[model samples]
Target: MLMPIAALLLTYLVTLALAGLAAFVLRRPLWVLLSELCGTEERSSFWTVWSMVMMIALPLLFVSWARVETDPTELLQGTVAATLTGILMAMGGMGLAVWLRVPRADSL
Candidate 1:
């Protein structure tokens, strides 16, 4: 029981880290698109910081999750928890970026 829960948490953490890396790599493109669409000289430094945080957080989550046995019921619960945690972490990273007033650069 406890092992399953731990596994779920670990998976969630790993997913978060992977997602953050993806975001970091795509940050430049994302910022360019947003700037062009919005026609604002705003910058988004949140991607890099968030990516770093996720890189650390996700692996931990996954390792913890993997400690449990692979049962159907446990798997389902773990998936849901991991998904929600990732989403929340992403949002929080965005929020932090906004709060920090990171400078926006023109990608053109």
Candidate 2:
């Protein structure tokens, strides 16, 4: 039980790191593209940040759920772990985006 939980925690952490890095690297370009597509002069990091988080979070949750045993306790624990992991990843990603400074849509 402990070993499986540990593995699950490690899996989520590693996934968070990778996903956050990817979001950091791509945020600018994605923002530019989205702004253009929407024809908006305003600059908002909402799309890039949340979209990336959801993109990874949803699939991860599904996969983790499918992989877990039918035991109620195990399912509850896995759900909690995945939720916490996602929250951490999103915060990290948002911090990165802000630290780097997303440019104005028209500036690029």
Candidate 3:
């Protein structure tokens, strides 16, 4: 039981690092997108930070839910691809959330 939790924790930390790096690389794009969506400067900053956190959390959430066994080797194999895929998945989620929350042009 402890080992499973430990493995998950390790996966979470490593993925967080990867996600942080990805966010750092893509910060400008994220900032622009968040700024467009937010009505105020304060909210833009809030959303910018929140989106980065979401990007980091998403992969860990998926892996935790899907894994039946916590094998670190399996997790680390092809880590680069996994990290990129994770970033994309997180960005997709951010898009979906914003789309759902935003007012439609048709409504205005």
Instruction: Using lDDT, give the best candidate's number.
Output: 3
Candidates' C-alpha lDDT = 0.55, 0.60, 0.72
What is candidate 1's lDDT per residue for 2-107, written digit by digit as tens?
Answer: 4656655655554555556655675676565445544555433444444546645654454355445466576656555655565566557656754455455753
What TM-score fits each model?
0.40, 0.49, 0.62
> What is candidate 2's lDDT per residue for 1-108, written digit by digit as tens?
446676566556655565567567766777776676545645445566566767467536644665653455765566556655665665566557555664768789
Candidate 3 per-residue lDDT over residues 1-108, each given as its tens digit: 338777666666677788888778777786776687787778888888888887877766665555534565675653445656778898898889878877889998
Candidate 1 stretches greater than 4 Å from native = 1-30, 33-67, 102-108
Off by over 4 Å in 3: 1-6, 37-39, 68-72, 78-85, 96-108
Q: Which should have the higher lDDT, number 1 or number 2?
A: 2
Name the TM-score of candidate 2.
0.49
Ten-residue region with minimum lDDT total, candidate 2: 37-46
Whichever of 1 and 2 has more TM-score, that candidate is: 2
**In candidate 3, how many Å is residue 2 off?**
13
Which residue pairs collide, candidate 2? none
